[model samples]
Target: MASSAASVLNRLLQNASRPKKPSQPPPSPSLILHHINSNNFAAAFSALFSIPTPLSIPLYSRLLRISASTRSLVDARHLESHIISTHHPRHPPTFLLNRTIETYAACGSLRDARELFDEMPRRNGGTWNAIISAYASAGHSHDAILLFSRMNKSGSSRPNDVSFACALGSCADLLALLLARQIHCLVLKYGFAKNVILSTSVVDVYGKCGIMSDARKVFDEMRERNAVSWNVIVRRYLEMNEGEEAVILFFTMIVDGVRPLNFTVSNALVACSDVSALKEGCQIHGIAVKLGFDGDHVVENSLMEMYAKNGLLEDARKLFDDSTSRDVVSWTSIISGYALCGRFAEAEKLFDSMPERNVVSWNAMLAGYVRCLCWGKALDFIFLMAKESEEMDNVSLKLILNVCAGVSDLELGKQVHGFVFRHGFCSNIFIGNALVDMYGKCGNLRSAELWFLSMASNRDKISWNALISGYTRHGRSEEALNAFGEMQWETTPNEFTCSTALAACANIFVLRHGKQIHAHMIRNDFNMDVIIQGALVDMYCKCRSIEYAINVFEQATSKDIILWNSMIMGCAYNGRGEFGLELFEMMLKDGTKADNVTFIAILLACITEGYVDLGHRYFNLMSDEFGIIPRVEHYECMIELLGKHGFMVELEDFIERMPFEPTTPMWMRIFDCCREHSYARLGERAERWINESNPLNPVEFNVCSGPAMEPS
Candidate 1:
């Protein structure tokens, strides 16, 4: 009895010391829903996994919806796995599974979305729409269209309004007009045309495809128009260069009581800028201010650009200064404004003062300098851009390469080429063209050709033009003509291509090639442009076909200053100086003002005719009357005219009173005239000037001195 009692006590003690199982809490669906509703997804996710009971289909569906709506793809995926693992060969509820698929699609995990979509034993319209929209949104338009067709053929689920919208969007993206038209017909057949969103999509697609009429027709047919509808058509008109139409539409929108959105105002302003309708632009600006959109960055930037384009720099500056918040675009606008107005120093100063600088700002500054012909300053900015660790994009590199070409800085261009290679921008077609052009301009034809050949598959007309122009510029006319011939088989020659090729023909005096190119131009209808006409005139003159040049000139219905100058120079080159002078008078009478080139041409004509008085009158008239500064070439022409007339005393006095010292070549011209007229004393003075100009070239100086040393 005693041992039994001891064993019972020991058993009781052991039982007392042992741990008891704690009561498990029930799953709180309300708590999970609350956390999810409050966007405390982490807490909800944690609460979900802690549930002791098996998750109901409703609960799982709710969680998946929350995940899908919040884009909690990770949690949605996790819950999906749990449902699959727990069900184990028994399918989860269709709603829960579909929500999971939608979540994946929304997260850009189309791969997972597709796998889940295919794995479902049963599918619904929502599931198909989810996957198709995902594909379309990811820029896989072809795949989206293919899947839509497959969905149609399946006949399992009829596509709804959302599906049609997604499919139409895909068609629009692909710019597949035929497919889009079929889809439009489908929309009509399915009676989805009444859906405003679908109708808007149709209009947008047509507009983007450059079918403005079709876009307008679709837009007009909309039973009820929204701001989006108006914006689309207005923007399309601006893009199609129909600025007046865009402005009219904006006024119509206001009359119809549709409030213009920011985009509408911005686009309307862009149209105004395009047409240089300053009054219309200012009206829009006032409307934007009244609408309280002037404070908006995008609208303000557009307004600034419009003002600048209209030459209202002060107004643009005022707008820029008044803005409370400024972005890179704002800075770029103001900089470009100053640049367009030729205030490069101010532009640079503004660029330096910017709180932040981006590639666009840098590019704007570079372009501004280039426009002002500040090549050295542009190059300096490029170097500074490099030092700042800013990755030079294709535009930056292209701009710098152009500056290098402008200044003929080959070493800097080579360095930029190295930068291009290092950054792997060589494969870009524009950069490739720029590189080829730069090399050609720098007198590195071999490298230019190599770069041109390297861009074999990427070569466009621009590439061909750059190469051909480079060759022509460097006097490699044969290569230029050969390149032009090759270009004919590769691509149709543009106006620039034909113009540059004609220039090559002119340089070599190849009338046959010129005629052939001219025939090509006529065949292709490329000769109507004034630029090409000017080229043809110059070409014929160089080929000694003065009559052909004159015929071409007479046929030009409207002649710009360049065309006028080309004709005048052609007459001068062909020794018809008097005719050239007569043409100049005709040019003046035609209301075409004479620029510096015109003056040069007329002066050359005077020199050709040995009209000393006429040359003198025109030279003074150029600066005094027309306000045209006389460049070195003009001075050179004056010297040549005086020397040719054997006016030694006058020539010497003119040289001594000139604003600039006479160059070696000018003195050489004088020396040649002295020899021709037997003016030994003046010839000795001209010899001394030439020798003093080239102190390093003693041998040439001795040779030049021999003539003056001769006793005449």
Candidate 2:
């Protein structure tokens, strides 16, 4: 046994002394990564620590990457400390430090990431990128920009593609056009333009800065383009209200053979929606199907919205029903579409059917009710929304306030105002504008002024316009004019602002102010749209400038029926019945179809001029030739014509044949005419009808009885 032990010890020493063939070096760091990737984290970590210091660097990097990806801050910190302890006094390799910084940033420990970045004895492009990206992702855009400037000044590290992309993103967030341009110059100087991501980032910066011309220029200059590059420009155009141009660019993108991403498809559909370009929308929808993106929820929702906004509710409904994955936006889009198309009942039904509802979904339904003039339903929805936990947003308040103003419901407007205060939405500029308009419309000028004063610092053109329009609506024409002058001193008035000012001038018959506004329109080269033309024509006529009204009418580039009606009514009011008839004939000659208003104006002219035959002819022709059903005013014109001409029998026959009961005002008109002609018998008949219409009010009967007067 002694001899065997001696021989074994001799053999062990002999084996140790033998120059052993170098055993295959311990499993590489890649092997350790293989274990980590397979989720054998225990074994991977054990192997990581067991490896030599030089090998451990790569192993630690792989582990840090996994930690960052999984957002395991604990493991990340542990690994970071291990790297620090293992490589202390001498700085860790730049790549390991970068990965560690990235891990910390990804874990939302930006403080740690930034501290480690600061402590790093050396940094490359990757180190700078990680920290800049960290700051940008955290919404510290200014800090990110400052760091990027430091990187540019630091001669040790040059701005690479990643660095440029991060810096450009910061500029985008900051909307720093000058800084972005400088960075763009640096990108070009550094030959980073060929990097697709860097180029895309530059384009995005320009877009966010509202420099679409530059954005397009950069995009056009790109040697290579991707889906993101196309999307950025298309979305920018949409934001700029160049929807038609956006659609054109979308088609151009398609022809360029770049495949549309999901975002691209959604943005293009928005462009189509804005322009109401149904044909182009349909073509894009077809492309989406071919690209298999039609099934994508965002694209489907956008398509639904486009169809809805274009009045293609049928197609919108079809798309809604066909969508397999319907989210809140999908339901909201369809509901809003129905509401916008004036199909309130369908919108309500669909809204009730939604399984899950958000604030946006509720707002859409409420807005629909308001738009369809279902005032009671809209108010009820507001109350219903109050009962729920879902908080009302600014859009909800704006829409409901509009409904209150439209229905002249002061009580409800006050309630909405209270809600705005309670919800702290009073500070929202849009809500402030809405409140001003609502209170003005409700005849609560005090409240309107209060809200307007409160929002003085935040007042935009819309805010000023709303106030001016409100004053005009309530017959505070002088106040509206003063407000207009104040607005001009503060901000440049838009077309709406000028148009409302013109309306104020018309209401007060201020010829001087009207002339000034007209001159301003001319100097500013404002487009003579139908609204402005109508306003000018009405203003001239109201100011006793019928020739000027006629001049304005003739200068209109494209006259809709409203403009034509305005001119006709102007002539009628000025007692130019002959000229009114001439204008009507001109309207017909120009293929401008007459509506109920047209016939009403023409009938008024006939009545004023005592053209009884012409009155009868136009009244009959209204329904027979023009398909315009005679409204109350048309009937009033007819009755006035017959009563003034002493055609009592025909007037009585017309009254009996009327479709609806004569309102109190209509009966008052008949009684006045009877008194004018001293027809006691006919007067008594009209008096009895008025009394019957208001049995409880003897005042109306008494007033009519004592109202006999001399004929004109």
- What local distance difference test score does each model get? 0.86, 0.86
lDDT by residue (tens digit), candidate 1, 226-325:
8988998899889888999999999899889898899999999989888999999998888888889878888999999899878899999999998988
- Tell how far residue 79 is off in model 1, in angstroms: 3.1
Instruction: Rate residue 371 of model 1 by lDDT.
Output: 78
Q: Which regions in candidate 2 have their CA more than 4 angstroms from the true location?
A: 1-38, 42-55, 150-158, 178-182, 185-196, 388-391, 424-427, 588-593, 616-712
Candidate 2: 10-residue stretch with minimal lDDT: 698-707
The candidate scoring highest on TM-score is: 2
Name model 1 segments beyond 4 Å from true: 1-25, 34-43, 47-62, 82-92, 138-161, 164-226, 233-259, 290-292, 389-391, 488-490, 511-530, 547-560, 588-596, 620-632, 635-712
Q: Please, what are the lDDT tens digits per residue for candidate 2 over residues 1-712?
A: 9999999999999999989687677756777778877998767766655555555655677788788888888888777776776675576778888888889988989988988998988878889998998888888899999999998898888988877888899999889999999999999899887888888898899988888889988889899998888888888889889899889988899999999789988998999998889999999999999999978988999999999999999999999998889889999999999987778889888988999999899888887787778888777877788888467788888998898898899998998899889979989998899999999888899889888988978898898998898899889999999999998888888889888999999999999999999999899999889999999999999998999899989988899999999998998899898899998999999998899999989988887788988899999999998888888889989998988886666776788999997778878888877766665665777788877777787422223344344343
Instruction: Report the Cα lDDT for residue 618, model 1.
Output: 96
